[model samples]
Target: MLRSSLAIATVTATLIATGLPAAACGEEDKPASEKVRVSGAPGAVKNVKAVGNVPDAQGAIAMGFLQYGHRDVMAVSGEFGLKVYDLTKNPAAPKLIGEVSLPGLWETEDTEVDVKRKLVFLARDPRAYGGTTQTGESGIYIIDLKNPEKPAILSYTKVPAGHTTSCVDDCRYLWTGGPAKAANQPADWGGRPIWVTDIRDPRNPKTAPDPIELARNDGKTDYVHDVQVDDEGVAWVSGRGGVRGYWTSGYHRDPVQGKVRRATAFSPVPYAGGGIEETAAPSKFMHNSFHPSGHRSADGADSNRWRGRDLIYATEESFLDGCVGDGVLTISSLQNSYNGEGWRSTPEKPFRLKSVGTWSVAGQEGSDPTTGDCSAHYFDVRGKVLVQSFYTQGTRFLDVSDPTDPKQIAYFRPADASAWAPYWHKGYVYVADNTRGIDILKLTA
Candidate 1:
């Protein structure tokens, strides 16, 4: 993998000379003539700042936030490598400060940034630079962000599964998910299982030599797309089968099996889980999720109680022709699933999760007329507000204070938008747009 070290440096130098902070490709040599398409109801969010590109706009995929001293730095991951921009000087307009070229780095949906430890974990999918799903080398690249301006890669440990990697148990361990099945992998495996990596020693990160495939609800090697660990230290693995919550490290009675057990990264004991039961939901393909506890209903009647009642905000990433079967956000109750047949149940007797609410961009206002993917991708939840990305639909803000009836508070949808993910930081929203680059927005009161 290090064979492209020289090429990486060469590409970096060329890009620097071309003058970054320029407009996206197809308009790099031109001026800012095209007006940015902005839309939202009156008193909605405002697009205070709009920029073209950061470094490699064409390959810009995901965005991560980090705060260094009083300055705010954002790391954007793309095809070639990762780019860090200093947003402290001006949140609206970012200044490119660092670049690390990774020539063949594949699809990086999410980059886990440990601001406390000053490290960023970049996952390398099996699908190589060309975007082919064929088996290839998949792993995570550990980068030291101690010097924000000049980042360095500590090491790249090859893991069996690598579509996305998330830090668990306070950055001491990393649970990498998604399969780029190796030659010796089991033939019956569907997609991927959770692969544990002990990164307590960042310099010498160690991953299990063999794959740890946990038999999921379907009694099959379920495809674990992404893992979202809640504030309560529950690692929720979402995939084709559904979403299952596991206790990584804790001493609690199993909600489903009704037994006392210890959990760990390598061996996750099931807490609670079930399939999403929504008629409008096309596929059961659950992308990613967010678990918020201690949330009371709008009327202040029901709240997350002592027994650990919480709400699961999940995004379904399904795409189809003519904007049909687009993904949406499904709100489910963890308590309902806990009382039912959870992770311990088998395929013969499956229980469905109770979906409380669902919000989509199917018939929503400000939708692009052109044929494109309207499916929801990655999103960020801040309090009662959920900022989600709906491909060409741009970024939409939904007020989930009333979980059942989510009100559309604000939105920023450009005609040519290819919005990927949205993150709320410092009272502002930063969206990773594939077309118009990173769009900075401010939510008005």
Candidate 2:
């Protein structure tokens, strides 16, 4: 049964308190003994070891960062709210310095950070704190990160969409998106779309009346999961249909509308991207994406085939009957996907991008076949290396130098692992796990 992350958390907490097996939480379908016993890749990936772990601090979800003086501090958001840790003293073992107690803060998957403004945006899902979609409060909590040791909530700005909040236009604005439709939502909508919020003045953040990135799922306005801004200032929205990129800043030639227009946060111009092919990902839901070339190379570069932001590395999140049927890491080429093909796509006349490659951990090395919660979740890339989290399947390290065929170079999955998101910080990879807290890993291969 594919349950929401919050519902799983609520059930898991109850199961754990009553001394019941956590396998019944609808996350891990197998017993702990049947899960992966080892913690690191021995032969497949050499020298990749778990250096440090914060086991007691369970219910950890996603990780973000904030600037503390000259050091880059780590901020974790999960069932315990948000906590700031100093990794300077020991990169492997982070020291907890400050924290804000948001006990039931649910589903802030990709925590957004404004390094320059010293702020953190925590998106509150409607299902947070045992609330239903009909009456649950959905909004954003602007946390002042100026004082890392004592973080304070600046304000709670309400918005229609709140599954994840992403900083747009250098944190001047925000694009918040969803879990499901709230009360009195559009009848034609399958799920929630994105809502723009003006946070230029962080204290008094104002939300736009309307939403952006409409009709994302094959012409149907569906669930917009998360937003990731590329290095070129183009914000990519991922959800039920696929991944789409929009220019949020300067004047650009709108490929879809075929005109030059100045793009704003609220009114973005279609740049590139569309839906992923069904062959690569049967489930069209793209949890998130990362454009490797967006940060380094120019568009249409001839040096490398995958460079020039021509390809998008995305994670298809799905929980099926078995781990083999779950989501996989998909590498899609944005060759002919531009010109608003995704926006123009319909159920009968669908337009999907060409998938170059795909990777899964179902029958991979050091995998536990019994574990059912094996869908790929959040991932982080560094150079040619990409580290991804797959719930009970663990943290996987892949070499994406060849974008068409991503090969697993290393892996770290303990017996009681429920890795949510893996982040590459400094030289170590920090994994925020639901069962285990923060597991710091080092890759020597």
TM-score of each: 0.83, 0.89
Look at candidate 1 and tell me the lDDT of residue 124. 84
Task: Give the runs in model 1 whose Cα sits over 4 Å from its true position.
Answer: 1-56, 179-184, 210-213, 255-258, 278-280, 294-309
Instruction: Give candidate 1's error at residue 229 in angstroms.
Output: 1.8
lDDT by residue (24-113, candidate 1, tens digit) is: 001111111221233332322233334334434545667788887788898887665788889887777788899799865765667778
The deviation in Å at residue 375 for candidate 1 is 0.6
Model 2 pairs in collision: none
- Candidate that scores best on lDDT: 2
Candidate 2 regions exceeding 4 Å error are 1-46, 294-309
lDDT of each: 0.67, 0.78
Clash count in backbone of candidate 1 = 0
User: Model 2 misses residue 367 by how many Å?
Assistant: 0.6
How does candidate 2 score on lDDT? Answer: 0.78
